[model samples]
Target chain A: MTNNTEGRSAFISGGSRGIGKAIAIGLAKSGSNIAINYTRDKEAAQETVAEIEALGKIAKAYQGNVADFEDCQRMVNSALNDLGEISILINNAGVASRGSLITDTNPEEIRKVIGIHVFGTHNLCHLLVPQMRAAERGDVIMISSVATESLSGRGAPYNMAKSAQEAIAFTLAKEEKVHDIRVNIVGPGLVETDMGKRLVKATRGVEDIRELDKGSPFQRVCQPEDIADAVVFFCSEDAAYVTGQRLYVNGGSF
Target chain B: MGELDGRKALVTGGSRGIGRAIVRRLASEGADVVINYHSNQKAAEEIASEVRKLGKKAEIIMADVSDQSEAERLATESITALGSIDILVNNAGIGATAVGRPHVATASPDDFYRLMAAHAFASHDLCRMIVPQMRESTRGDVVMISSIAAQSFGPTGGTYAAAKAAMEAVAYSLAKEERGNNIHVNIVAPGLIETDMAEMMVKFQGRVKDSINELAADSPFGRLGYPEDIAGSVAFLCSERASYITNQRITVAGS
Candidate 1:
């Protein structure tokens, strides 16, 4: 509803569905054109583009695997060509690790999860940050998880990947200050997205996330839009002086 | 209409410096405010007039919040004036230089207690008195204006750092305790803003020969932070845009 980011464009990885889609829409609502990146689900990506277009903003979908540097390069070039110099990068693509102890987990599963979360984030930043440095201002937001804080057992891959992502955020925040680029981490707790539902169903044996509301802070599970709100804030001018900060959107609970 | 239209707020130390900037920023966002000051009635009234010019109701209340009885009275009087306080900003505190920053070994217990009472205990008392009523409102926000010293704890800053650290602990705990009640508690820790307090600190430390301007020229942004810079983050934290954020510290230090 606020045109806080007017004339700016954002490139959001894994923006076809779930939390990524919510962030794409939130940025659009804040008056930024969008380039949505998706590895699969072209239809979902197209639908998101249309939704953003309906808001009177430009939107396009790019197919890319963020884990691969070449794919990220190609997508970044295509997105820049279509969207005209994106200044906001939302590294929201992530994969959950299978809940297995390190001893029982297959090494391949660990690699795949880490590749998607850690390497994917690095690939995007590597490709886009140079161009971002030239812009009047820029923002990079990492959609991390509270797993970094809990470091819960049986999810070593997820926790490690998010921690590394935050490490990059803090490091980049310091390095890019001279360029007027702000890097921040938005860590969400259990949310009501596809990934969150699967996590809850797999771990807690609950078919409906609402059933866990009694135990959750604020008597409800976090929503994808709730996480999106934080991303928008980090990108807004209201946060112009804030950088290298990590805001956990877990309703004040662990 | 502004995002905070019809909301009521009470800002401590609202007479000057960062507190004045916060009072004006919040009023501009459509919240009627009560400006709390200890000794600067003129400055408080000036900010009140500025708030009134923004088409929001503004009131000034005088109380030395470091004193428990005065803090209690401030809360009661503020609630009486504004009907209900949906937003509370704990921005009152003495400067590190004012307290004469001393190393841990040389710091007096009296100085430690004085700093603690002014920053940590004052915030704790106000939260205790006002947070219960905040629960009855649709939304509630409490922001502690902390300092980056809480983390740095640099040399000769023991008392100041301890006070800010204690305040942060209270804020983090209150954030969790009131989450179920729809209240969001956050801390905004500023780094060396260009305020009278900062000027005094810089002068007292003799960091520069003449002015903070010389120091600002060498700073990261090529300029020292302004009170408005801190106010921006505070305004955002109190807005609906930050509804999902709690128990977080946003350092407005131009990292």
Candidate 2:
């Protein structure tokens, strides 16, 4: 494994399962200690902690809803206290959009989706950036989606939230460049995860998640490992000079 | 130790400029490379010698990438010589200034076609020929060298920008099409790099080094991008660390 991230510590929101969990494991393999933030599912979060500890790295799990600004501060403070000077912060906690179209979707549903994705990302970056900036070696990553580039009619709330998240990332990248902090976004396409499963069920009304896999040239759904790898790359020394970039781990789908 | 050790790479236009840097960088990281050139066998051979000094295998092939038959032949020959191609970098193309500055009305239609053939068609043909063999490998990567002109083009820069835009479009499609096959495709778009091509562009614009440097100073990095800057990003994309990264475009512009 690349030692690019060795001796670093990362705070990954929603690291209990799915793409977030995979990123935690990937970072662990790169020799970084991990602080995982999960809203619920203590059992799953503990499982992740055990796996990281087995890898001979310090691991801790914090319960917090990132959508709430106060909870974000609590999570970041807890992570700093547990892990010491957090160098990497990944905004990965997100909720799937329920409504397919803007007109048909309830305003409350749109608010919820935006609250978790946009507000959650803003909360984490707002609270944790000061410490990261002080460290002089920092990485702030936003987990976005390829849907921002899509012209598809459906999934309006999801697309809007992701677009806003990317805007924030790009803006931070420029604003934080003087501080030697690298800010970027990793946008993943359809992956075989809990969110992916829900996305398929909601969008295509398909009970079998396999249906979405057929559209991909690879004839399979994107693995969470794929997204994790991209996230790790962004955090690694290999990308030290790469800033204000958006890397999509969509396996070639637009 | 380099992260790309034991990999076999083929870089088109690997004789000089960004392609040469990529070839050298990959070799330093433990990958054997095939350097492809159109009419610069001497330069290609020189780079090959340099790669060999890095303790990796290096071979040179002469082929006009824009020509379908030549590109197809090069792919087949490269695979046979290197056993397999784990990474392919499509970096061969004509300079935007080569056709001279002319509006669409006065511009030769043939020039636009030539640009398309060199930038877009060549990449497509090579990917078609090489992807099958690449799929057989555990990890495969393809990097297309595009330009920032694709995003912002001047009046006379239409052909070059259009061709690059088309190349990017192809890259995006190929990325989705080949993801299931365990192949990762990406684009590296450079902005105002200090290369021979950039030199020609500067001369065409009647711009001197002082003016260019002033422009560079205004950029985030306070300088023009170097070939190595682009090469380093390509190297990262080719490594196992970038395994989950596919269908992405990383612009190596200073800003």
Candidate 3:
């Protein structure tokens, strides 16, 4: 599109790889600076920063576990210091489920999944919305999953966390609209990513993730760039009037 | 070139307000257009001329969508004029409150049915008339121009809100039913926009309490929405960029 994102800054969690990295690149392509958060994977996070720098945009990486409230506060404050007044916030850090039914899933695994997806999303919004309001404009996005709608019996933890995340986004959309902040959810289905590969290997016993792409009407799995495009649209001037919406990037698949 | 390089579209209520803006935006994006208007032939023709100026084909048809048979006729005429209908925007409706002030207790039953026929029934009729044609295309889009009133549930806007809510529910169901055919059904719900419809609401509210200017001041953005604001969102949804997006409700209402 256009370089309308110039002078804007964004903070995205889990920006080391997969969908988050693609979003970082997409925003940078539109001329926005980035502050990326990663729980571990310092090497991958650094590589993301390098890629953004290669594209002539400023970027830096921070270490934090978004599930912990204190870590979120620290990362957000540091990101503001690094990138100056964050205009966009993406709560994307998450862990995939172990594909256990509700009764069979371990309590600790459930807690971890909920902690990362639900609490992590709230923590970032709680920390960043005030500054966004002070500035009088901002965009917040939650990376949810189409699993919420499919309600796969084996994905209870992931479904519970993602469904909860969407509810939070809807409520915040109403609450933040008065302040000129737009909140939205981008729910991708069966995207070809590291997590998608892992899920397929565990569930379908397949090594190649591309095999899961067959059933979509489009005859392909969703790519990280596909989801990234939706995020960029929601963060763009074109979406100024759009808020509290959940866009499903599922390639016409159920 | 634009996103809708070879697409053809039909927009109901294209004479004025948000519908007119959608017609303009789609034309600007390189889509040939057919617009349906109930009574404002002058305004409809004017928009058609503007669309032609954008180097696109444009036609204006006269049909009151609130009539089921008339809506079907309009759909038939739209396809005839445009050659194919790749995009259908359900934007026509009786002005939101021509039915009268909002209290359910005081609201007339006839007014409720009239509003329902104008908003929900008209959309349902048009969707049924056009989906078969849409299925023949490689990609098809249907956008329901709803209202935030459906979600807000304001006391005075019960009939209007109920009609919009029913339309949204229908849109969601249609999204599921039509996904296999590659037809995307979505909703665009605009908040308080600056239009003749909003002006009417202001005048009706004036008798009860506030002035028109106060209504403008109500948005968190410090102003009412321009027609282009809603049109921009609709244009995005109609583009290929939104192929992966379906069964969604986007509100063009600023916070």
Candidate 4:
């Protein structure tokens, strides 16, 4: 295996911890200067940078909410300022909640989820895409969910939002082909991470959900690093000529 | 410039063997590779170290592919993390006889069907949902891996073969339907590979008699295909190099 991030730079959103943090570290380990974006985890973000620097690769923490468009733009611009142009963007930042049933959910809460899950993702693409097109080569990946397909319940708003984000990703991949930017989606099943554990708890409350799991006969749930590995592959050359596709990274849990 | 210089690919079930070889191959060519596994984040990290040695960026992901909701989440999250997905390798599959339709005569029917649906049919379901995007943008290619079992017929191999066959038919029909659109869809039906699954098949009930190399040499190629060998074929199909190839099955067997 060869590490080519040597001269490359990558800027990823929601990259401070969890799957994002793992991906940042992986890229740094591969030799790319990394720009880690986080909403409020300053210390965690710095720690991620420290890890990247430890790898002898340059890393900078870019603070911003993954919920705001302006923040997304600023985050991208700042990363470019520090590391030239980003060759890849891993959209790993996302949020999950304990609330269920949209009828009982607050409107503000819905906005929070949609803003970070969808809009924040959009903001970065809007700014970074043009530069990638100009370069005639770039990759755009959207961190999606199995909820969009398994839409079991109360995941309604979240599912719709992710579906919309996927729409934008496909649209960009289709339209941007003239410039050669590839747009794709990565779908992962349950992982053992904070986000995944939260879901396991949310639905494990239901008999059918638990039964569904056993019925599937899957192995261990999964981990953040698992999802990050998928990210690294999507950004790699092996996937060249692969565009406008969604890669599901679940164990046999499907 | 290969359409993938700045591109990224996330291959689930990618690790030592086919997945690992895929990571090395992709990274060697210039695109970054993210190696994913179910339990071995350490192995994933080690694979990361290997990919790093190539100067190509690599990441490790532990997301399980079967959890439907998580499936969508992971896909979206990855798309966000990398700017785009030029290739999607739905290589994440499990080989299981424990939960299968083995024609055991005593095995429960449900176990048989579920086994096929989970491993063989699932990836197509993924492509069914994910390929429209690929179609919408640049030229898209989906390489679904199937075993010679997909059509081997009858008895203990019932469920696995049926499910794989179903997926391949789906891939072939879809390939034919989308051929005009330039969305290339193909299948690599590996008769005998060095994977554990192959080893198990060879040992199962004397189904494959002879040593691994003895069986491998049975193929027209005079040797068994390695993961890297198959990886090369897959990468080519996804490259501009195979622009004219679509809707076909390329069987790798030694003569």
Task: Report the C-alpha displacement of residue B58, candidate 1, in angstroms.
Answer: 0.9
Q: What is the TM-score of each candidate against the true structure?
A: 0.97, 0.85, 0.90, 0.53
Chain A TM-score per candidate? 0.97, 0.94, 0.96, 0.89
- Candidate of highest DockQ: 1
Q: Quick one: best lDDT, which candidate?
A: 1
Preferred candidate (lDDT higher): 3 or 4: 3
Clash pairs (backbone) in predicted model 2 = A218-B180, A252-B175, A252-B176
How high is the TM-score of chain B in model 3?
0.95
Regions more than 4 Å wrong, model 3: A1-3, A68-74, A147-152, A167-171, A251-254, B102-110, B207-211
Q: Taking candidate 2, what TM-score does its chain B reach relative to the real chain B?
A: 0.95
Which CAPRI tier for candidate 1? medium
Give the lDDT of residue B232 in candidate 4: 61
The C-alpha stretches of model 4 lying farther than 4 A from their native spots are: A205-218, B1-255
Model 1 residue A43 CA deviation in Å: 1.0
Rank order (by TM-score, best first) = 1, 3, 2, 4
The lowest-lDDT stretch of 10 consecutive residues in candidate 1 chain A is A1-10
Best by TM-score: 1
Task: Evaluate all candidate structures by whole-model CA lDDT and list the values in order.
Answer: 0.90, 0.85, 0.86, 0.67
Candidate 4, residues A113-210, lDDT tens digits: the string is 78887887778788888887665357788888766778766776677678878888878777775566667787766655666656656766532333
